[model samples]
Target chain A: MRRAVSALLALLIFAYLFGVLLKAPIPGDYRDERYNYYSPLSGREANESVPDHYVERGEEETGSQNIVTSIVVLYRGFDTLGEVTVLFTAATGVAFLLSTQRSKGEKEKKKEPNFMASTGVGLVLPFILLVGAYIFVHGHLTPGGGFPGGAVIATGFVLMLVAYPRFQLREKKVSVVEAFSGLAFAVIGLISLIMGLTFLENYLPKGVAGTLLSAGIIPLIYIAIGFKVGSELSAIVSHMKGGEE
Target chain B: MMANLPFIMVALFIAIGLYAVLFKTNLIKIVMGISIIESAVNLFLIAGGYVKGGIAPIYTSAPEGEEMVLPTPQALTLTAIVIGLATTALLLSFVVLIYRHYGSIDSRKIRGLRE
Candidate 1:
C-alpha cells in the first residue's frame, strides 16, 4: 500500500513538472537586455547588463582570460569563500562523527588489493596529480578551476587508498596543508582590504591575460583553493574509508 | 516544446529522486535519491544559462560578435557541485554510522528517535 501511494505521488509530481516544462520558455531563446551593461549601483536599466559587460571588459578589468574565473574569484569571491567554509565544515563533521569508532589500528584486517589494480594505480597516480595541478595553475586561461582540479587530486588519493589497503595518509600533514591554504586564501583577501580596496579586491598587477602568471590575485586565490579543497576532500575520503572496516 | 526536452528530463530526474526519498525504506536508497535531486538541480541551472549559438566564456578563442553563455550560472553550478560533494560525503558518513548502530539501514525499523 505504501509503495502504491509513493508511486502515485511520484507520478503526480512528474505530471506537474511536465506541465511546467511545457509552458516554460525554451532555453537560449530568452535573452534579457539587462545583462548587457555594467551597473555597480542601483537604478539604471541601460547600464545593468552584467554578463555582456563582463564579457566585454572582464579580461581588461580582472586580467583573467577566463571570464568564469573572474566571476568566481573576483566578482563573487565572498560566496566562494563561504563555499569553501561549507566544505571544510562538512569534512570536519564527518571526521568527528566517525572518530567515535575505534582507530584503524584496532579495526579488522583489510584484504589486499589485486596486484593488477595496485600496479595500475601506481602508474596513473602521478599523471592524475599532474593533470590536477595543471587544471588549477591554468585556471585563468582555461575551462578548469580549483574545484574540478581539487576533485581530480582527491580521486588520485582515493585510487591510492583502494589499491594499497594498508597505505595511510598522514592526517597531520593533510590537516596542515588544509589549514595553511585556507589561511592563505583569507590572508590574500585581507591584503587587498589593507590596500584600501574592499575585501578580496584585486590589488596586484593585472598581467597579460593569456599568460600563465597573469591575473594577479586570481591564480594565487585559485591555487590556494585547489590545495585547500584537495586536502579537505582527501581527508574526507580517508575518514569514510576508515569507517568501512 | 521539443527544445525543452532537457527541462523535461530534469523534471523527471527530480520526480524520481523525490519518489525514492519519500517511498524508499532503505537509508542508502534515500541518499541516492538526494544525489539524484542534486544532479537534476545542477542540470536545470546549466540549462538556464544556455544561449543560442553561444560559445564558451573564454576570451582567448571566442570569435568576435559571438554571444557567450552566461558565466555566472556556470560558476554558481561549480560551487553547487562542490557543495553537493561535501553534503553527499557527510550524508554517507551518517548512513554508515546509522547502519553501525542499528545493524541495518531500514528506515522503518530504526525508530529510536520516535520512541
Candidate 2:
C-alpha cells in the first residue's frame, strides 16, 4: 500500500516534469548572440551580461587564467565562505554524533588487509596526494580548484582507511589541520580588508595571467579551502568508522 | 541528436532518483536516492550552459578562437556539489544514529521514540 502511494507520487512528479520539458525545449548548443545575457545592472537591452564581460575581459581584470576560478574565488567569494561553513557544520555533526555512539567498550578485533590491497594503496597513495596538491596549487592556471583537489586528497585517505581499517589517522591532528585551514581562509579574506579593499578583494599583485603564481588572492583562498576540505572529509570518514569519543 | 541528450538524461536520472527516494524503505537506499537526485541537478546545471563547441572557461593556452561555456552555471554547480556532499554526510550520519538507537533502518518500523 505504501509502495503504491510512492509509485503514484513518482508518476505524478514524472508527468509534471514531462509537461515542463515539453513547454521549454532544451537547446543543445547556445551559440546565438541572441542568447547572450540581457544585462540588468546597466539597464540595457542585450548588453553584455556579467558572464560575457567575465569572458571577454576576465584575464585583464582578474589576472586569472581560469575564468571559473576568478568567479568562484573573487566575485562570489562570500558565498564560498558560506559553503565552507556548511561543510564544516556537517563534519562537526558527524564527529559529535559518532563519538557519542561508540560501539560499546570492547574494540572488535580488526582483520588484516590483504597483501595486494595494502601494497597497492601504498604505491598509489603518494601519487594521489601529489596530484591533489598540484590541482589546488595550480587552480588559477588549470581546470580544477580547491573542491576537486580536496576531494582527491580525501579519496586517498579514504583508500587508506578502507585498505587498512586499523590504520589510525590521528583525529586530533586532522582536526588541527581543519581548524588551521579554515582560519587561513578567513585570514586571507581579512587581509583584503586590511588593504582597504572589500572583503576577499584581491590585494596582492596579479602577475602575468596563465602563470602559476598569478591570480593573487585566488590561489591563496583555493589552497586554504583545499586543506580545510581534505581534513574535514577525512575526519568525517574516520568518525564513520567508529572513532572513540 | 546528441545535443539534447543531457536534458533527457537529466529527466531520466531525476525520475529514477525520485522513485528510489519515494519508494525505498531502507534508509541507506534513500540516501543513495538523494545522491542520485543531486547528480541529476548538477547535470541539469551543466547542460544549461552547453555551447555547440565551447571549451572550458580557462585561458591557459586556450584555443585561439573558440567559445567558452557560461561560467556562471558552472560556478553555481560547484557550490551546489559541495553543499550536496555536506548534506549527504549529515544524512548518512543520521542514518547511522538511527540504526544505533533503533537497531534497524527500516523507516516503516521506526514509529516513535518510546522505547
Candidate 3:
C-alpha cells in the first residue's frame, strides 16, 4: 500500500512536469535559417540550419565523410578528451579498490570451465576483435566510432573472462596502451597548438572525404580513443573479476 | 499531443526511476534506479533533437531535401552514455566495498554512512 501511494505521488509529479514541458515554447520545426545561422565559435552567420551547416560544410572542413565523427573528434575534441579522462580515472579507481588483499581462506572457489563455453569463446574471440578493429578503423566513413568499437573490444575481454575464470589480462600492457593513447591524444592537440591553431585544431591536410585513408587527423584521434577506451574498460572488467590481487 | 508521446514516455521512465531510488532499500536497486534515470535523460536529449521528418545526420548519400536530426544532441548523448558507464562502474565498486565492510547492502542497516 505504501509502495502504491509512493508510485502514485511519483506519477503525479511526473504528470505535472510533463505538462510544463509540453507548455514550454519549443519551436515546432527547426528548419529555420535564422535559428541555424548563428555560430558562437566564429561569431558569423550562415544561411543553413545547424545540422545542415555541419552536413553541407563539415566534409570540406574536416575531410571526413562521417559528419558525426567530425563533430565528435574534430569540432568538440576537447570534450572528448575530458570524457576519456573520466573513464581512465574511473578505471584506475576501480583497480585501486579491487587491489585490496583478500584473506587466504576467503579466496573464491574455482568452478570447472565448461568445454563448450571455452571452445565457443575461443572460436568467436578473433572475429570479435577483428570487428572491433574494423569499426574503429572505418570510423571516419561508417556509422561506428571509437566508443562503440572500444566497447566491442571490451566485450571480447568479457567473453574471455566468462569462459576462463582464471584468465587474467596483463595489467602492465593494458596500462601502457591506455597511457600512450591518452598522451597521444593530448600530444596531437599540443601539436595543433604549436601550429598556431587553437587546441585540437585539425592541422593535418583534409584529404578526400570518401576514402579509407582520408579524414587525416580524425582517424588518428579515433584510433587513440579506441585503444584507450578499450584497454581502460578491459582493465575495469579484470578488476571486477578480482582474480589478481 | 501525439507528437509529445516520446516526451511523455521519457517522463514516465524518469518517474519510475525516481520511485525506485526513493522507496527501494537495496543498494543495488538504487544503482539500477540511477541507471534508469540516466537512460531517461538520454532519451529526452535524443527526442529533443528530433525534427518533424528528419533523417539521420549522416552525409553519405543523404536525400537532397530531407532535414537531418540534430547531431549535437546525439553527440552529447554519446558522451553522456560513456560518462554514465564510468560512473556506474565506480558506483558498483563502491557498493562492493560497502558490502564488504557492512556485511549487508541494506540502506537502513549500513550505519557507517549515516554519521
* RMSD after CA superposition, every candidate: 2.8, 2.6, 2.8
Q: Which stretches of candidate 1 lie over 4 Å from their true place?
A: A32-47, A103-106, A243-245, B113-115
Calculate each model's fnat, 2 decimals: 0.86, 0.71, 0.56
Candidate 2 has a DockQ of: 0.68
- Using DockQ, give the best candidate's number: 1
**Per-candidate local distance difference test:** 0.89, 0.86, 0.85
Quote the RMSD, in angstroms, for model 1: 2.8
Complex DockQ per candidate: 0.79, 0.68, 0.60
Give the alpha carbon lDDT tens digit for every residue of B28-86 in model 1: 89999999999999999999889989999998776798988988889899999999998
Best by lDDT: 1
The pairs that clash in candidate 2 are none
* Per-candidate chain B TM: 0.92, 0.95, 0.92
C-alpha lDDT of candidate 2 relative to the true structure: 0.86
Task: Compute the lDDT for candidate 3.
Answer: 0.85
Residues A1-245 of candidate 2: C-alpha lDDT, one tens digit per residue: 87888778877877777667655545533446356455677576553767777888778888999999899999899999999999999999998887886657547678889799999999999999999999999999999999999999999999998899688779999999999999999999998899899999998899877788888889999999999999999898888887743
Model 3 misplaced regions, further than 4 Å: A1-5, A24-50, A101-104, B112-115
TM-score of chain B of 2: 0.95
Candidate 2 chain A: minimum summed lDDT over ten consecutive residues — where? Answer: A24-33
